[model samples]
Target: SGGPNYKVALGRRDGLSYATEEAVLSFLPSPTSNVTALIDVFTELDLTTKDLVTLSGAHTIGIAHCSSFENRLFPTQDSTLDPIFAENLYLTCPVINISSTTVIDIRTPNTFDNKYYVDLLHREGLFTSDQGLYEDFRTKPFVIIFALCQHLFFENFVYSMTKMGQLSVLTGSQGEIRRNCSALNSNLSWYAVDGDGHDGKVF
Candidate 1:
């Protein structure tokens, strides 16, 4: 992976509890979102338009399930998609092929560089939300800049990511510093629950 390494801001505390599925979904922008919708979502999160374009570079190295973008393929192929790219996607994901997956960045699929912006420039961006950034005037300039220079993308990505990490931060006594991230502090029990709904000592 040609991914850049940056020092992450540490000392961030975790929330005392997890967010509900509805809450999580509410906070996340949908893949089918247009540029305006994406910008609005990020703006609500206190991120700038530049940050929106920069952070989306993360798409440079991931796979997306067909269901996430099949709408763009079916009902009618998205006109903005490159003809060759759309044909390839049709082969990878036909109707009712929900389990099929495709790489986000067709060019340099495994690399974490600026190829995602390159893909956008060529109209090969896999998601509407992604390609829209290139067509939207507000974000198109940054897209062009990053596509022309990988160094700037990496630098801005780092800054935007750090800034994003600071949002809604939990301070002293607001959240916990979990000893183990997977299990909640309250779930670290020495006993198990019996079928009768009683706590039974594991010993």
Candidate 2:
């Protein structure tokens, strides 16, 4: 694979910073978001539903905070959950109003794997978004597909990441190149040119 080794072209200008409740709410896709909604978002950014599911498989690597799913543990829960899974969740999350920074995934907390889909089948999904995958018939088949083909999951992941990298890219004198990754001082502020720019910026 003769992939080009290239430096990102820099010099892009930063834009006005403003945030609204509605804007934040619109961008945060809930687990219950349907295929159509997902498709619309992707289309808006020149992507596809296939890319949506493929990229989402990246969830297998991280933990969701307890606040993300307190509803599942207190007051009411989906009756479909296995009692053992529910009990395990309680041990990890507890009943008290704990901080939102609790770990939910007990398996491979730092590695990518199909354990998320497996967890879903067992009713061990930590967030409503995670659990919603199985609850929605449209998404369940894809979840099962990911669970079955580990190699395919990895392959698709790579493809989606590559595609995502191209979306909204700022190149050719568009953004400032950072000299120090941590230090943020520049005559002209830089902006992220791709989708991954927003990563780790929010919970």
Candidate 3:
């Protein structure tokens, strides 16, 4: 898979039920998660450190809410952040209950590239998990590799994403395709098995 020329395997069925935010909170790494905490969460998804670093390149495009990185600026700016980067963030983010937006990638935020790795190296990463990749030796090498070679990052990204796409796969007749993308096709009770072998259901 490369660029928009790739096709994901089809006929995949949606989960019977969606996870509540509280239920999902435990599984997701916090914005301030350390390398260890991040590994624990990604490990549950069968993604390795290399995968974590490479996959994080997706942050290259998109905007983040201020709440996602405000802690790094307010109270006390994170020492890991470059002084100029932190100052810019403080100007962009307010400490109170307000919504704000900031680019995820400091370099070419409009493009999908391996610049995220470089951003991490420069202490320009938006989240702690991102900066952690550069700080931790285990994942740092991969970040460096990805930053130096976009081709390698692209290849690895395709493979990791392919693996991720297959993690919770179910075969024919296991579940029904949703008639609507936003809502379940039916309200009647339905069930499906997850990647971790847990049975999921819709109320």
TM-score of 3: 0.82
Two-way TM-score contest, 1 vs 2, winner: 1
Better of 2 and 3 by TM-score: 3
Model 1 lDDT vs. the true structure?
0.89
RMSD of each: 5.3, 8.7, 6.4
On residues 1-203, what C-alpha lDDT tens digit does candidate 3 reach at each position? Answer: 12323567776787767768898787667878889888888898988988888778888888998888777777888899999988888777857445978898988888888888889889999998889889998898999899899889888988888888888776666766665556665553464445786556645
TM-score, candidate number 2: 0.68
Put the candidates in lDDT order, highest first.
Answer: 1, 3, 2
lDDT for model 3: 0.80
Q: Against the true structure, whose TM-score is highest?
A: 1
How many backbone collisions does model 1 have?
0
Which 10-residue span in candidate 1 carries the lowest summed lDDT?
A: 177-186
Per-residue CA lDDT of model 2 for 73-142, tens digit only, reads 7877557667887787777678747775544455655667776677777787766666666667767887
Model 3 lowest lDDT segment of ten: 1-10
